[model samples]
Target: MEYEKLVRGDVELWKRKLMKRSSLLNRTAKKAQTKMNGLIPEKANSVITESIKKMVQGALFGSEYLTKTKAVRAATLEELDKEVKEKLNFYKKAAAVEGAGTGGAGILLGLADFPLLLSIKMKYLFEVAALYGYDTKQYEERLFILYVFQLAFSSDQTRMETMDKIDHWETYKEDAEEIDWRVFQQEYRDYLDLVKLLQLVPGIGAIVGAYANYNLMDQLGETALNAYRLRWFNERENGQKQEKQSGL
Candidate 1:
């Protein structure tokens, strides 16, 4: 009957695994920083400039680890079935103990807060990825959109109280780590409405919505990755533009 104790134990085990993963990530970042310093031309730039670039690179790689972190965090809290419950609840006097109650309150709090956390994670991940010569803006944007969709469906109230107190989607330089969950939800709602127009197609149903949502995400992610591949073209174009301006 004491499901809470069982769940807590499971969570503890999962936490240990997470901690190990985090340790490995930290070690990798440290090694990367070392490598970057060794490779950069020491005399070409000021110490501050070189240090900043290295820090940026470290942050970018750190963000890639966020993807794994998110997946692991979700798997750690999977719904408990009867078999899992039995295995977890080894404590005797099962009927004598009171249920700790549905984690509704906790879930509500997480739903309210997860979008903001996820946004921070995405931006940080993008920063880290960008350092490794990867353009992750599209992936970050798509993930942000997915987080918005999740926030919308997680709560019954269409209007979240948190929206009134916060702002969102400012330039990345302004508040890269902060996101207004309520505003994000409103944006997703608008996006969802636009996709609804596509539902008029003959074979499209609820699946149409699902396909649209994921298709946009896939496209965004692919765009971000593709930008890296086209970097040489971009550099050439920029060079030509600069030359034209100089000639003028």
Candidate 2:
């Protein structure tokens, strides 16, 4: 019970942080990205969008093959949280290593880091879903994973909209259209462009790549954990309400 209370408190605090207004730095960066986006040719934008869609589709299907099924034995939330944290540690190390290896190899290999890192992130999310006792094999669960990914990497305005969908996911999913791949790819690219560009530089690429990937994993891990926490609490509340209604 104490652990539950602590987790609830943490979730509340995370929610507050999530809903906060963007800092001046973030706004400025977004404006620059917008200008850059406008300068890109429409054909190139389309190509990039299609490429990202395929890459993400590949990761989604690939991760499903690798992800474990839901735990057979039920575990307490604290136990699940502990295990998830351990997995997050492993993933952060893995991402850092991958980033450094690619970065140190120069431009061509650095380009390879994009798909590799995306794969690692998606794989970790699949594992997290399983650890939280969800079946990633379900289509809706995989869709939820994408929502979590978008929430973690989008601009403040997009993040706010994504969060609202995540908060009311049960209702939203009933009529949810396929994700806008154009928006998905653009936002994701915009979020990582600066750091990833630094990763392509010759001399300091290794260090930059490692540090950036490690921190990116940290951010994704935290976002995934809290997103699940929100689901956990929501489900519990719904179950309680159902039981009370039945008792009446």
Candidate 3:
């Protein structure tokens, strides 16, 4: 019970933080991103579109990661969290390095960073989901993982809508046709607008790229952790409800 309370406390803190109103900087960034999206070229849009499609496909349907790794045996949430954090830290450092290398390599490599970073992020989520005792091989679980990604990168407006979707994922996912990948790609691209563009600049790109990827991975890790917790809590409550009904 003590452990559960502590876990709930932490989750509540994160939920509150996520719900905080957008700051001036965040609003400004969103507006700037809206303008930039309109000005971006067809080639740039295509690259982003294609990269995200590949990412979603690999995460949802690819067998490579599932084949290579076993589902983590269920343990207490505390134990699971420790393992998840270790994996998150490992990937966080790796992604930062990848960003820096590409950022320093000029236009070609900077552009290459998009798909590379997407792969890194997706891989980390797969591991985190497995660590939390969810089977990454399940299509529904993978779709949940994608929602976690969107939650981390979406605008304030979209974030609220996505939060509701995640909160009722078990019920909502049953009837949902499929995620609107176009909206996912747009929200993600818009979220990264300035920071990603800065990564293309010649002199300062390395620093920007490294910093951006580091934080990006960090945010994803945190979001995934909380998302799994939300699922666990829901299952826990449902179990309790079933036990009560059975006793009656």
For lDDT, the strongest prediction is: 2
lDDT of 1 by residue, 67-170 (tens): 43122111221231332223223211111121111112233332332233223324433532333333344544433333333332222222232211111322
| Candidate 3 lDDT for residue 72 | 70
Worst 10 residues of 2 by lDDT: 66-75
Q: Each candidate's TM vs. the true structure?
A: 0.24, 0.96, 0.90
Question: Which candidate tops TM-score?
Answer: 2
What local lDDT score does residue 181 receive in model 3, on the 0 to 100 scale?
74
- lDDT of each residue in 120-183, candidate 2, tens digit only: 9999999998887777877888889999999999998889999998888877889888898988
Pairs of residues clashing in candidate 2: none
User: Is 1 or 3 the stronger prediction by lDDT?
Assistant: 3
Instruction: Give model 2's clash tally.
Output: 0
Ranking by TM-score: 2, 3, 1
Backbone atom clashes (below 3 Å) for every candidate = 6, 0, 0
How well is each residue in 1-248 modelled by candidate 3, as lDDT tens digits?
A: 68878988888898777777689999887888778777989888888777788877865555434434467745788788888889889999999999999999999999889878888888888887777767876778778888899999988888888888887887888976667777799999888877989999999999999999999999999999898888888888988999999999
- Native-referenced Cα lDDT, model 3: 0.84
Error at 79, model 3, angstroms: 0.5
- Give the lDDT of residue 64 in candidate 2: 86
Relative to the true structure, how large is the alpha-carbon lDDT of every model?
0.35, 0.91, 0.84
The list of candidate 1 runs beyond 4 A from truth reads 1-186, 192-216, 227-232, 240-248
